[model samples]
Target: MLWRRRAGMNGESDLAIHGATPGENIDESVRALACARHLPQPHLDRWLAMNERSRAAFLEIAQTLRLRTGQITAALELLEEISVRDATDCADILAAPEIARIRLHAGSAPARARELIETLRARRFPRLRETSTRLAGAIRELRLPRGISVVLPRELRSDVLTITVEVARVAELDGAIEALAARRAAIARIIEMLGGSE
Candidate 1:
């Protein structure tokens, strides 16, 4: 019956019963140990033996609890870093709206608009490369298009070459923003669970 009761307590309950609630329990247990110092050796030995299985179970539970807690903490820290980086990227995008607007404006002369578009494309190349690399790695195991082409001006005309690369670039930027938002949300949830905040 004692063994059955011990088994029913599982591991976490044993730790709780051992008074491992934080700082108070440790000090309490220390005082208890000092008082027990005067007890007979045989009685102490038998008591420890009787609690051996409970101790083992509690140790296992403590290890797992610490490991999971550490993992969650690390993950939250990483997400915070990602959120900051993503916010910086978003700020860059926000500051560069003029570039995309210039590319989209139909009244802008083709040569001038083309120059602005080319500049925007060059500026975005590094970010696009990073995003594409991640996407490529994710899709490597599946069969998909190796590359996609978008028509400029979105209108088909042999004489008038109207193709805006900015559209695709903007889409990629939006996707990156969305990805960051999702990561931030996930991090927020973990932080809430761990009793932290943004």
Candidate 2:
């Protein structure tokens, strides 16, 4: 289970499983108990203090929502594309409602994972994503040079932009740069399309 920090009854901080319904299995409970046995004194104290129902729920939540290594890695990579603050906020939000919703859905895990990421990305960076989409549309209208690509910052902290120009030879480099520069006004129009810079 991926550990989440939660406030304890005494106002101290500790790691606990966040989402548990009554849908736990005996096997999972046994595994959880085994794991609990190896925990340090303070953590073990908290675990042992839980009532049977609470302990059972904890075990169930831990088993059911445990993120696999691949899922964790993918989520980290996805979050890396955004601001650190947004990443932290997304993680805090994902710990509960999103995890529960995704778990209850009927679909391929990968598909659901993609959906979760896209949804979170949109939520966390609505304006930036919208700006990027509109910028792509505007750039498409220009029929950009094959050797050039436009890249926007995930979070638009400023109006600064990057246009990548790829060329095989020195002769084509100037042409590629010029072609991209020719579309500057069109690219600039994206702020208007997005209803002003966000």
Candidate 3:
């Protein structure tokens, strides 16, 4: 399909998708970029399926952020899911504070790209994000001594809590053990939270 854009009343440029008929002044700019990046056909189809504003918005993001193939795919899927769940537009999703901060503000592009995906994931899974936040707060509340770490399962996908102690000496190890024991009740609360105990 041919891609073009026009200015919206809000000053936002909107993308145009045209049928792939012969001699229609096709706009291959976006398609060329997608091809250069080796974007998978299925994902490319998904991209093409998005509305004009979303297509333009995502195109701007993909270009500006230098999103890799995998990142593009993940971001697209997350955006699609978020739109379906929230009944919102992809452009609106990209405009969110957390996303816009990373997109419009600056740091490493790779880091921002990763953050963009993660931010979208958080949006897509609000409850999981909330649970993760609460669990992280609980972990911080423990105030375990240095060299001791509380590890929660990735995404809290399972009811597993891993406690690690790093000590260079028997004395340090003993102190770590003591510190953990002192925080046993607090730590248990964290474990209970992980186990869906509330």
Q: Which structure among the candidates has the greatest lDDT?
A: 3
> Which of candidates 1 and 3 is the stronger one according to TM-score?
3
Candidate 1 per-residue C-alpha lDDT over 83-147 given as tens digits, one digit per residue, 9 for 90 to 100: 35555332233225453344334553544434443443444455544443443343332222223
* Residue 4, candidate 3: C-alpha displacement in angstroms: 11
How many Å off is the CA of 31 in candidate 3? Answer: 1.4
Question: For residues 1-198, what per-residue lDDT tens digits would candidate 3 score against the true structure?
Answer: 355656566444445556664222222545776798898888888877877667777887787678998999998899999999999989898867677677666598898888888888888999999999999999998888889999999988889899999999999999998999999999989988898888
Which scores better on lDDT, 2 or 3?
A: 3
Off by over 4 Å in 3: 1-27
Q: Please, what are the lDDT tens digits per residue for candidate 2 over residues 100-146?
A: 46645677666666666566567567767877777777767878768
Q: Which stretches of candidate 2 lie over 4 Å from their true place?
A: 1-66, 69-107, 190-198
Provide TM-scores for the models: 0.15, 0.45, 0.80
Estimate every model's Cα lDDT from 0 to 1: 0.34, 0.53, 0.81
Candidate 1 clashes between residue pairs 3 or more apart in a chain or in different chains? 152-162, 152-163, 152-164, 153-162
Give the Å shift of residue 130 in candidate 1: 21
CA deviation > 4 Å runs, candidate 1 = 1-15, 19-22, 26-62, 65-72, 75-144, 147-198
The candidate, 2 or 3, that scores higher on TM-score is: 3
TM-score of 1: 0.15
